[model samples]
Target: MTPEARKNAVRWSVFALVGAVITVSLLFGGVSDFHPTAVVRKVYDEVEALPDGSPILISSDFDPGSEAELKPMMDAVLEQCWRKNLRVIVMTICSPNSPELADSIVRASADAHGKVYGTDYAVFGYLAGGSAPILALGQDWHAVYKTDRGGTPCRDLPAMKGISKLTDFPLCLEISAVSTIDYWILAGNAKYGLKLGLGVTAVMATDYYQYLATRQVVGIIGGVSGASQYESMTRQDALRKARETKEAGDLASARMPTQSAIHVTIILLVVLGNILYFAGKRKEKASP
Candidate 1:
């Protein structure tokens, strides 16, 4: 090959190599036993300790753009709640994307745990008008979510049978990419006195902490790392009495694996590019 052509090839190869290394490193980091913060631990512990069959509202206040951080957190929370046999009520107050994203995650997570829809959990889906919808929930849940996402009447769902208002729920967990905490605080918690919790991105964690300190929120699980922490907390709680280490260890493990795989694949591409670059250089030097 021409010298110029060969040089261009080597440059591209180098770029590829760097990309690969970064990818792999990130992948390893994701699976690595990254420690959880005190806040995360508190969040997990509170949720885990809730009485079985306790109802909790999980609001998927996220869009496609923020799914990366929010999705994993949602998965982890759902898994823990399902394992503990919590009655989850999924809803979305802020974004239009809430219904689809929240429903997808809940259905998948529930399926994994063999949770029957309308019995084990019920999704109220996206309620209209943000705070308006939330406030309506305080007055009467059936008024807002007369039917679930599947078009089944909420009154007919076993999960919604006795639950009429927000306060009836033992806990309310809002998994939001947006800062819609105020609506719930104003409508649900302040009005009816329902216990509220938050799962927000790391960026939002700080602000939520302030809310938590004020007792506005019972707990806050912030970011993907926080989700991983919850996973660990779940495992610990599940096997607390089990003599076998494996059973206990299985708890809190991440239900999300795609992020790690993507990181690893990127790293491999980077490493290969570097190797090809060096190999091509050596070949060029050896030739006339």
Candidate 2:
């Protein structure tokens, strides 16, 4: 075959293989749950140990751009918190759209677990002043957020009863996709000694490993794969809960198969491309 024809054949072949893999994986689960990483396991274990009615803060610092990757993470975490009967106080400092997104996830998870609103969970809308807001929240939550997204006073909310400051909560979870995670570490964790667990995009995962190594950050769920791992852990917990009562299992990791298929397809294409290039180079060298 001519060089042009060979290139076209290779390209079409790759497209066909990738498409098939993605379709099959999505239809029937492709990715198997591997062993949980240490950081992810720590996050799960900490949440698991929290007693019922314990208050925890979840800061979602991502916008719609990162919704696909971070939303599942948020849902899985919130579901676990609800299953443990923990009071979830969710807030956002990234975008104006974040509060609504956080609220929807929390409400859906709470409803699934038959948890009450206002009592079991509360979402304080976008807090202004960037790091300043986080600093104020750490010192005095009421000073920063007097009311929730709905305009109800924080004092009136049953979930915010004993939560006067950031340190009041045992755990602070940040589902972020930007530098907001750094802000949380510096302003909240460094100063207030707040224990933090992070759910960051894959791209930002490596940047924070040093924090985990230093014990500055308690745990991390990095990217979609990490989210899937946590989901698997949460699913096992749900199964145990199911034995006692009818409860839905975690579905946040359902997309793992698709992600895995795409990754594998890309890796195969890379190897194939490299082999073809070297083979063509050898043929040219032999001819001349």
Candidate 3:
């Protein structure tokens, strides 16, 4: 075949393969279920083990750009926290959009778990000054966030009582798509000896694994696949508690089938391309 025709053939093959993969994924769902990774399982186990009414801080630092990937993890974590009856304290410093997103996710999860606002959980909204705010929080949370997201005084909120600093909480969880986790590590963990866990984008996952290895981060949940694993674990926990499966739905699991299909298709294409390249090279050498 002519060079142009060969290129065209490869292009068309890729298109067909991608289309078929999408179709199958949409119709049949993801090809396989993912077992929970050790890191993800550790996060679940830590949250599960927290005593009732234990206060935990959550830093949600991503906007809509990462909602699809990080939101499910946040939701699953929130569900786990609320189910265990832990007091959740939420805050954000990455962007102005973050606080609202964090608030909505926390509220939705709180409502689902029959948790009360200002008592079981309190949102501090968006604090300014980037890492400075985190530092301030570590020093004095009441000074950093004098009021809840709704303008209610932090002193007035029952959940905020006795939570005067970052070290006051036994566990601090951060679901971040940016370098904010680094700030948390520096200010909260390194400085104040705060126990930290993280949920990060796939790209950022490797960046933070070193922290996990060093024991700075107690555990981690990385990307959508990580989220799916945590969701599965949470679902099982819910089942054991209620004696039946909960219908809260798993968004990460729903997206996995499509991701798995595309990944397999791409792998097949790579294998085919290599085989064709070798075959063409042999044919050229034989054309005496």
Candidate 4:
């Protein structure tokens, strides 16, 4: 056979093998449950179990570039808060881009949970000056967020009616791609006594963990996996609350199969690529 034919055969064999592996993985690993899906779920569950009408402040401090790691976690936490009928105040620091992205995610999740704006949730929009605005919020949330995102008076919004300060909120959740979590720890939790739950990318998780371990922050969700874990956990918590608690068992179970399969597939790909490389080297040595 020609060299071209041999190359084609190798390529086809690899493709078929990959397809089979993926199929097997999906069939075996596709189950879902109530355990923590990611680090964010822990954060979400911390707030979800809070009393209804309890104020929760969320500082969504990421831009579109980091949305993949941030958006799902935001969705999970906001969904839980809305379901629990918690009063929410969504804001942003770092980038002007964050507020709009956060607003869209929160609103969509709230709508899914049948929450009403101006009543169940409110957006204070983006605050400027990065850490400076976050610090100011701790000092006086009302001064920082006297109005809703759309310029509506906070006094008129039932959700914001009695929320004059960040301390009034029992929980403060910060979803950050930047290091904005530090500002919350320094200002909000340390100073104003707000409970801090942080959602950050996997790379930033360690930086936040020191605070988490010290009890400076209540909980954290790290990266996409963390977000998925949190979503699964919250889903389980909700399912358990209802009569359909059986689904709760599937959360971690379902995810583990996929995660394991992914690891295996990566290993297999590396092995196959190395084999191809060495085989090519042998052919080169044997050539005329």
Question: Candidate 4, overall lDDT?
Answer: 0.74
Which stretches in model 1 have alpha-carbon errors above 4 Å?
1-21, 26-30, 235-288
- Compose the digit string of candidate 2's lDDT tens values, residues 1-288: 998998899789888988898788766663345468898998888888888889999998888898888887888788788778899999999988888878887788788788887998898999766789888988899988988999999999999989899999999999999899988999988988989999999999999989988888988899878887887776666434533443324444556667777998798789987998899899999995
**Candidate 4 structure quality by residue, lDDT tens digits, 83-149:** 7778888888778777788788888778877888888888877777756776676677677777888
List residue ranges in candidate 3 displaced over 4 A.
1-16, 30-33, 237-250, 280-288
Query: Residue 143: error of model 4 in Å?
Result: 2.2
Q: In angstroms, what RMSD does candidate 1 have relative to the true structure? A: 7.7
For each candidate in turn, the TM-score is: 0.74, 0.87, 0.87, 0.74
- Global local distance difference test of model 3: 0.84
Query: What lDDT score is found at residue 29 in candidate 3?
Result: 69
**3 against 4, candidate with superior TM-score:** 3
lDDT of 3 by residue, 1-288 (tens): 998998899799889879988887766663234689899998888887888889989999999999989998998888888778899998898898899988888888888778899899998878777679878888888887889889999999999778888889998899999999988899888888988999999899998888877899999999998998887877555434322332335467667878887988899878988998899899999999
What number of backbone clashes does candidate 1 have, counting pairs of residues 3 or more apart or in separate chains? Answer: 11
Q: Candidate 2, which ten residues in sequence have the lowest lDDT sum?
A: 242-251
Residues 159-226, candidate 1, lDDT per residue (tens digit)?
87678887787788888877687788787788778788888887888876777777788888877667
Clashes of each: 11, 0, 1, 13
